[model samples]
Target: MLHVAPSPAVAGNRHRRQMLLPWLDAEGQRRIRESTVLISRVGGLGGPLAQSLAVAGVGRIVLFHEGALLDEDLHRMVLMHPERVGEPRGSQAAETLRRLGGPHLEVHGFDHRITEDEATRWMREADIAVGAAPTYEERLLLNDAALAAGKPFVDAAMYDDETHVLCVDAGKSGCLRCLVPEPPPWRADFPVLAAVSAMVGNLAASLALRILAGAGPIPWGELVHFDAARIELTRVRVPRSAGCPACAAAERTSR
Candidate 1:
């Protein structure tokens, strides 16, 4: 059911030509071309992640982000333009992706954040969900939606020079709620570097591509941490919390 369309010829497409590696062959590329990914926020982290997916041939992207662009957001929002300031961030991001991905890629841009009431409806249209919101509330909402829809979820976040990426495969892996049972205190104006945000976003994109293409075993439930300060990358398994209300409720429903 994931591969909804027939595989298109990849012969002369320059964007996908370079991606033809042993790990991701023509069939893999076709899979990528048919997948629809939902991104929670098209800001710092989500900007690069959506751009990478667009260029890599994702068939569609659903973007959700509230508010108009501010001058301060340009430092890390790669898809946003200075001229587009005061414009809706979601629509601007969608326009940028459409320009990059050409006519084949479809993008639905919402000028508001995904609400609890709308989560299930949106999740039904996506094959996977990626969360890059600054707030734990949004990330956890996305996690619950993805789990309920039986879709993979990737949680990407960064603070200053440090980055964190978590890939969850619904019932098979721990959800975001498992790692943070209660919402942690976080600031909306978190400090971040452009380069570090892009690095983590691209990393999350790569993980997403692997999952979409079925290239290899997914690192589900693993927390990938990158410390730009020390130039270190670490991976640790996140054990599923037995008391996680989000995933636990999902597990019970599956039975």
Candidate 2:
């Protein structure tokens, strides 16, 4: 069953956007057509990222966000138009994405919070997960889900002018656990401008497709940071810790 625009209740046409998404070869496109990604929220960074993923032709995108759209969110998550201001965020994003793309893309909007169990379930169905949530609480839950489900993940964050996309391999590549041994610095209002969010989020979506299609020499488990304010780009090694919780946990369970 395919996902369509305006998100009709019926399953969409399977071969709708066969011509677009030319980044991959025939085989790569074929793989994308068969893949599924579960994005936690379709707000802020996740909005454009999910849209690009749909445009790039991910088979299905299961979106989970619990609230309705607020007038304030229209600033950065521009997909939510004034008309859909009061609708469920996930529904609005799904509708907009479907309309922008086509039925070949599948967008499932869940009106529930992404709890631990829910995250794991979504990760189970996803080839890779993208964590663009604004909080470390969400990131940690995402990490556990990816690790337990053995799915690769891409963690992206934006703070005003600076943004980064960190690719995670659960137990293989340095997961988020490697970078921060303790809780991430909690920011009540993460300083992310729309421009910076769009830049980094799109990169995350781009890298997600590359990982899925096995395209070129993949830059897996690397931290790509961009300071849009300064027009700078930095590639840093994804740090791994000897006592990282996820890695140590995986090893302990394996042993």
Candidate 3:
């Protein structure tokens, strides 16, 4: 549920441009204002994702990323600056988001990875969950938590020169586990370019907003892939695996 207040007058002045859109009038903008999004790992993809959602006027954003900023992260992590290279990424990101998001938007940052116990609480509280972690282990954890809490999960990833954006609508869509039951055998670290990550991050945010506001024809269980080298975009529908542990369990319980 969105944390919306029944205000007679909409704050159209702040988001006038968005309000002007035919689908997103005062009511739609208000929906965005009342929504809460939980974004995990505010590094390459998470950085721009948080920024885009803030600009879109999402009511609240809760970010999770544990570690200090690295010099290398400056290239892709938009929330990071060279001056804060050694500072905590979560705190730095939260502070930056608060400033960029203005006073109306609520921002919370956790400097440690969300525990299994904490995952459900945060997922249930938020209207949406985004997985932007660099490792498949972390991404899988987020998927489990989001599914358990009955929240939609948006995943964005960039590898080499290719990027993938996917959204899992819990029971209705194929989840991360459904797509990849096991983590890839390759090492976690990979080559990344800021330009590519930022572009994919913005697309992920756009999909999230569409799902949240019910404004556009969201992909739902589809995967949106981008190949920067070839400059091509592809959409592929992903089907749910009947044997998927996480989603399969949910299905059995519901029936």
Candidate No. with top lDDT: 1
Predictions in order: lDDT: 0.85, 0.76, 0.83
Model 3 worst lDDT run, 10 consecutive residues: 1-10
TM-score, candidate number 2: 0.86
Which residues of candidate 3, in runs, are more than 4 Å off?
Answer: 1-12, 252-255
128: Cα error in model 3, Å: 0.6
* Candidate achieving higher lDDT, 1 or 3: 1
Q: Model 2: which residue pairs collide?
A: 3-106, 5-98, 5-99, 160-191
After superposition on all C-alphas, the RMSD of every candidate to the true structure, in Å, is 3.8, 3.9, 3.6
149-183: candidate 2 lDDT, tens digit per residue: 77778888888888988888767778776876557
Give each model a TM-score: 0.92, 0.86, 0.92
TM accuracy, model 3: 0.92
Clashes of 3: 0
- Pairs that collide, model 3: none
- Tell me the spans in candidate 2 whose CA falls farther than 4 Å from its real position: 1-23, 249-255
lDDT of 1 by residue, 138-214 (tens): 99999998888778899999998899999997777877888887789756678888899999999999999989998
